[model samples]
Target: MPTTFRQHRKQDDPVLTVDFTRFPLAPGDRVLDLGCGAGRHAFECYRRGAQVVALDQNGEEIREVAKWFAAMKEAGEAPAGATATAMEGDALNLPFPDESFDVVIISEVMEHIPDDKGVLAEMVRVLKPGGRIAITVPRYGPEKVCWALSDAYHEVEGGHIRIYKADELLGKIRQAGLRPYGTHHAHALHSPYWWLKCAFGVDNDKALPVRAYHKLLVWDIMKKPALTRVAEQLLNPVVGKSFVAYATKPHLPKAQA
Candidate 1:
């Protein structure tokens, strides 16, 4: 049976990487977090005063995310009028009508699905004209190193099926009828941590180097140390662990009959 692995995800996500300002979400905007693994981005959207829908295929994850949503509501972590909903759904065929959402987020999810283009199509289908999307995938070089280091790093069930080059991913977004606008890399400090884990053993949490690096990551995430933040920002362009692309659905010019 698959465990929740809640302990494995203690660190808050790298919010700066998503750069929500570029997406231009406003209060009451409809936001969909496709494949939201535990509602990290969804929660952020809610906090920004958007109506957030956190969708995932994993029932267990959805349940956990729903609990978090309720907790956030009870604790007033979200904005005054914000709302959130967590649901189980298929990414390839979203249960939404065309042009339904103002913003869509599919973070660190494309590499896991074999039919990536199909999933992109579904995201595009659900996005309103002029809507924006942010897609994140495991960067090619760093992910290649992890794959080279250990088969277990990605050869497991539901693991990343492929690595995506930045250009290749951008092209797929364009093919899906979205206009590519901006791109960035993120989590540069995390590349070496994964490399260490892959070098020893993916599951060897007790390994000294792995444990130390994990601690460092936890600190970097929780503390926001100035030096490490500066270093990560500098290294992100060169060796970030993930590549993020932002795109918008183009509004077609009116047809002349």
Candidate 2:
């Protein structure tokens, strides 16, 4: 869904946009990672002992994820009751039945699709009552800067089609019949790296500044030293690159006779 430099989640530990501390997961909970590019979040959920289904329209990525899941299972990376599945499926039409999942996550996926509301509706439909959902997108300010700097950044197919402000996204969640409880920004440090990419060329990873920034991000994600962690936390509220929101589906009232 996201064709940005942030898609470089190839590390042993995936760089997750959702903070599990806030959106907690338990063992055996049914979890879905819609638009699960590279199976980053799905891998994390598997490790956390959830029954995970990583779905994506990209058949190639789905195959790769399935391989990794098998490897994890064989290696005992996932705990005793944790099952994992990776399948190619459309976000607009999920194959699961109603009230099928305890948690649903769609990160960096909504902006690429034209019918954002349709995607939200599908998420609401599949999530069980009281089940949680996390949605993340490119934040408005940083995304606007990238748009201003480079048309090539968002003009390509499967690139980000729209940047969303926090309130706007939360409102859509409410409209989808989910009650949003909390929200925050993430990846403040990576914003500038993307900005640099936009200024240079989205595909030109060989550029000097882009290459330099790429090293810094890999180091930050891998080692996660105190300095960058603290810096990202402090800067997140202001210039963070991605906006994350957590919501839960509510039970319906009884019908009148």
Candidate 3:
């Protein structure tokens, strides 16, 4: 009886958008949310009736997510058939056997890994045939603005090592043996909000415009409706903050076999 958080709040944004359509989990599915920062998507999977494993390199966040999972279990917020657990693990080398999960999520994580190919291969290795994987990275245009604004923004500890173009990422996924199925942009409003922050200072949330825009973005995610819907969809392809691509492991044997 784990707790659940309704994620219907952002039907337009990229990460959650992919979760809604691309990563639709059925009851009894085994799902993996790699680099699950704070477990947002993991919680959503559990709520949607999947056994979810939320993994991250950060032990603290994993601990917090585990605590929340425990609390949710006690509070009876999770779906009747779903459960969740959190663990610490690295993306480049996952701690699971081949074909371990029916679905895998890697949201806003690939950019942080230098060997993104290795990470993708690990994800592919653990996915069951015909299993799905959803990946989200900062969209090229918006990320370029941040790069132009400050060298330090992407140069500091745990900072992004590379910004991916959608096509390039899709190609990479294909190279890792997954078949691309769909692509979309999300968090359109948040792009300019982050642009404002990067222009001010990446860490300067205290600045007036940055602070104000941050609040607005938070409000938009919390109370999503018609206006945000039109705005996000209209802005996504052009200026969305994140690019999400969904793919599946083709259910075919290797050509050599």
| Alpha-carbon RMSD, each predicted model | 3.8, 4.2, 3.0
lDDT (0 to 1) per candidate: 0.87, 0.90, 0.84
For model 1 the TM-score comes to: 0.93
Candidate 1 lDDT, tens digit per residue, 1-257?
01222222335555445777666679999999999997788877887899999999999999998887776676666787788999999999899999999999999999999999999999989999999999989899999999999999999999999988888888888889999999888889989999999999999999999999998888887677899989998999999998989999999899999
| Winner by lDDT between candidate 2 and candidate 1 | 2
**Model 2 lDDT tens row, 1-257:** 22221233336452688999999999999999999998889988998999999999999999988987887776667899999999999899999999999999999999999999999999988999989999999999999999999999999989989989888999999999999999999989989999999999888999999999999998887777899989999999999889999999998988999
Which candidate number has the best TM-score?
2
Candidates 1 and 2, the one with greater TM-score: 2
Q: What lDDT does candidate 3 reach at residue 17?
A: 40
Q: How many clashing pairs per prediction, in order?
A: 0, 0, 6
The order of the candidates by lDDT, greatest first, is 2, 1, 3
lDDT by residue for model 3 over 1-257, one digit each (tens)? 22132243142233364547655778989999999997778877876889999999999999988887776666666778787889999888889999999999998888998899999999999999999999999999999999999887799989899989888999999999999988888878888887887889888879999989878777766676679879888988899889989999989767894
Residue 211 miss distance in model 3 (angstroms)? 1.3
Superposition TM-score, candidate 2 onto the true structure: 0.94
Cα error, residue 210 of model 2, in Å, equals: 0.9
TM-score head-to-head 2 vs 3, winner = 2
Q: Candidate 1 vs candidate 3: which has greater TM-score?
A: 1
Off by over 4 Å in 1: 1-17
